[model samples]
Target: MYSIHRSFADNCMAVTAPVRSKGRFTIGCDIIEADKLSNRLVALLPKTLDLRAANAVRLGLRELLINAVEHGCLEVGFELKSKIAESDDYLQFLLERQKLPEYRLRTVQVEYEIRPQRIVFRITDGGKGFDHKHRTHKAREDDALAHLAHGRGIKMSLRIFDRVRYNTAGNSVTVLKKLA
Candidate 1:
């Protein structure tokens, strides 16, 4: 396959956010970019008045954002990622994947709307989604601190968001945090 020939930073520069009464942020899978987007989104929510609640939302948002990037856009499998994490090639693998034509252009999108009672976030990725029917909301609380990398974010997200729903395709997830 051919390469896209752009640096991750270059791709991140293309992320576009147009703020208003509602907000949307289109982003690449880079962690720095994801964290930044999470922070920006949380800042827009007045419902997170308590510091602890704000932090929880921030953490969950970041986790799901990374999930969309790695599992969805980058196409890194759970077992394969675990295999790489125990070695030194994981970073190299991600870098290589990010240059490939199929993966390089894929992106994760985060759209948010503030309703009278809650804030909703929809994070969608450009990849073939896995089967998610078997995934449970409480699947990995015990594994949250384990050496495994893939399951904790989703678990944390379930705890933080008031509601979490996944599309049948599994590439898109929607989360809500209540205001009152």
Candidate 2:
């Protein structure tokens, strides 16, 4: 048995409903500006994770959100970010991009679902997306993560979460982690 509840506050509408899965319950959904991700995550994380697992989840979520904002919303590609990684101007570039009306207005939608066994996150960004298929696998080589400026996040998420899936368009990702 499941139920749905909806409410509106501060011009934001939140819907909480259950997924078809037997134990799954939708907690809440939020649409946050790219710039507000850090603050939002900082506030919600403690409630979402046990202290033992908090660090890994925090790292994975941070990486994904950053990718959604910088790469997806702001249209920063791998080559561009990689070049910026080699310079000291990356933060300046990001700040400039964040100030753009087009980028500033873009948002990432996050949906949270809780199950007796696990918690699931569905994060979608208002951007064209990327080629996530190529990055799904764990790197077999020990050195693959050594110098990479990007992509380690997905790999880390794969290790931390029981499952991580990306939509075909790559604009959305669903990650599942078992409850402690």
Q: How much RMSD separates candidate 1 from the native structure? A: 8.2
The 0-to-1 C-alpha lDDT of every candidate, in the order given, reads 0.75, 0.62
Residue 109, candidate 1: Cα error in Å is 0.9
Candidate 2 Cα outliers beyond 4 Å, as residue runs = 1-49, 138-142
Please write out the lDDT profile of model 2 over residues 1-180, one tens digit for every residue.
112111112112222223222221111112133324433332343243444475466567767777777777788887898889788788778878877887777777767666656767777887898888775644434557767766577777777878888999999898888865
Q: Which 10 consecutive positions of candidate 2 have the poorest summed lDDT?
A: 4-13
Q: Write the per-residue lDDT of candidate 1 for residues 120-154, one digit (tens) a residue.
A: 89999998987665555345446644555567777
lDDT at 155, model 2: 74
The superposed Cα distance between candidate 1 and the true structure at residue 122, in angstroms, equals 0.2
TM-score of each: 0.80, 0.72
lDDT of 2 at 108: 71
Model 1 TM-score, all chains together: 0.80
